[model samples]
Target: MDEVEVVVAHSERATLRVGDMFLKVDADQARIDAEVAAMALAPVPTPEVLWRKPHVLAMAALPGTTVGRLGGPSTGSPGAWAAAGAAIRKLHDAPLPPWPGPGRRPDELRRELDEECEALVTNGVLPADLVTRNRQVAEAALRPWTPAFTHGDLQIAHVFVEDDEVTGIIDWSEAGRGDALYDLATFTLGHEEHLDDVIAGYGTDVDLAVIQAWWALRSLLVVRWLIEHGFDPFTAGCEVDVLRSRM
Candidate 1:
């Protein structure tokens, strides 16, 4: 037998790769159920569920490299990004999942954003004006959206590519019904240069303003969580840069 490969070992959960299978162990049962349910309904390519228990879910490993890397260039060609965009379009066009959750309600987000901005400013993680400016910019994304099947955390790393095609999308934990542009923003965060490629592949004109707003809003919201988890958002080519870019 081969050694177990620790893919990600965060405080809340950990994923291990063992002999072509991935075992995801999470503490939150609801999140685990959401992941399983979302994967089962997504229209795009996803891992095959091998089995599951209360806290552990096993899935078949996917083939191919990710569409891009975080904080760096993607070795995948523009064609691959386009392919990923097309795949996302397919998913967005699918029927809504039964469990979309409380969702990002504007009132909740406004309050949450205010609190997160205060924390960032109060703790000096980011400058006060930077948070304020980004918060104002984030307002553009607060409008109501027609909910689509959204991969809540659609980073390029979650998309796998082979031969300029999307082999599969992984990490269905955040899958639900939400703003389509939010997923677009999440994927393009810190990688704005590739937005045109992804949009081209999406086969339609999209509202870039909403997507940009999401970039700011999402970055502001996640930095604190990243910090609490012992991750550095200010490191090169990461969330800090994404927030700063808005300034």
Candidate 2:
């Protein structure tokens, strides 16, 4: 057997290059990759796709890795962040067909919260009361709004940066119609100082308070997930602190 070149590895999936083709796999996660590939190529004006073999193989590898060197000091430059913000704006502005299905409603999100709470309890990571409280706060905060197509897991790690510019955005499995500000909030929550630059780049007059609320809610959810999955809590806690400072 030959060793495949590993492109990226996450808790959910591992991307590897086998000969001329690329393969992505996880425990029963191939279906998700197929769905994401379909959505990404659905006249969305995103990165060009080369080829795909059902849910198992998808080819298109850009040169360069995510920003910030491994085990090194934070190299997330402000200029790079500004460029990424602009890239996000372009992505959001792209015309996407109305998402199918019932879409994300507040009631549905509340049910998801309940499910997350149960998962956290089963993992014994945090007090059940904490999860419930966080969910209640998030639900109440998100209730007064409509949803839109958003990159559900927008973060620095998902952005491919080279020479202070974003070459591409990888990982679309979490993309769906939810809230317009969801991605922005997720990106800017930890790096609050970059919010000004991102907002300026995005050139939107949306309510800052609402954006801040989203940031808080998203941070709480991220923390809950991290704890449940036994991941590091430091990063999520830092984001939560940033949101708290703004509040």
Candidate 3:
């Protein structure tokens, strides 16, 4: 018998590993449906769905290790990182999903950012200067963007690689049409050193300022949420550090 291993657990969702299979338990069936649909539509490699039962979806594990984890050193080589970038480019180039997906609209995102920033300061979660400076930096990302198919939460941990080749990208609950730069920023959130390598494989020129702005914006918006979800965004090399780097 395979011992069950808790991959991740929070209020909204949890994932468990039993033998070689991963079981995702989500409170929102719509998110699970979206994830399944996005995986079907994505051009890149994705895990094979073994089965599904209402809120629980079981999937065959993909081969290879995650590119990296936030707050940890990336074990992937430059080639692997470039391969991840190439995979992301393919996903972005794919046709948009019929549904709006999970990314917030610019106006909506602005409101959320402002509210989160105010709370962070008022609740003494972060210093006023830090919040203010990051807010200023984040403003650049609030501008309109032409939408592209995006892995809405393209965190480094979601991308898998083996021998400098991308094998799979997992966790598609947030996949949708959004700013392509946001995906890039999310993938390299704390690993900014790899941006040039990713750009080399992305095979296009992108606005560095916009990417940087997205970093601040993403970090600032998610800090409180992360804390509430039992994630340590304030850890060294994590979201808080990412915001501080902008200051």
**lDDT per residue as tens, model 1, 97-130:** 9876546798889899989999899999899988
Candidate 2 pairs with clashing backbones: none
Model 2 Cα shift for residue 184 (angstroms): 0.6
Tell me the spans in candidate 2 whose CA falls farther than 4 Å from its real position. 1-11, 16-23, 26-50, 65-74, 101-103, 114-141, 144-147, 235-247
Q: Rank the models by TM-score, top first.
A: 3, 1, 2
Best by lDDT: 3
Off by over 4 Å in 3: 1-3
Candidate 1 TM-score to native = 0.95
Instruction: Identify the runs in model 1 with alpha carbons over 4 angstroms from their true place.
Output: 1-3
Q: Output candidate 2 Cα RMSD.
A: 4.7
TM-score of each: 0.95, 0.69, 0.97
lDDT of 3 by residue, 1-90 (tens): 459987678999987878888799999999899999999999999989999889999998878987778899989899998998899999
Q: lDDT of model 2 at residue 234?
A: 52
lDDT per residue as tens, model 2, 1-247: 3778876665666667665444656554654563464456433333445555444546555555565422223466767777777777766765553543223566766676567667766877556665555555455455655555566667656666677777666556666555667778777655666677777767676666666666656655565655556555555336435434543
| Global lDDT of model 1 | 0.86
> What is the clash count for each candidate, in the order shown?
0, 0, 0
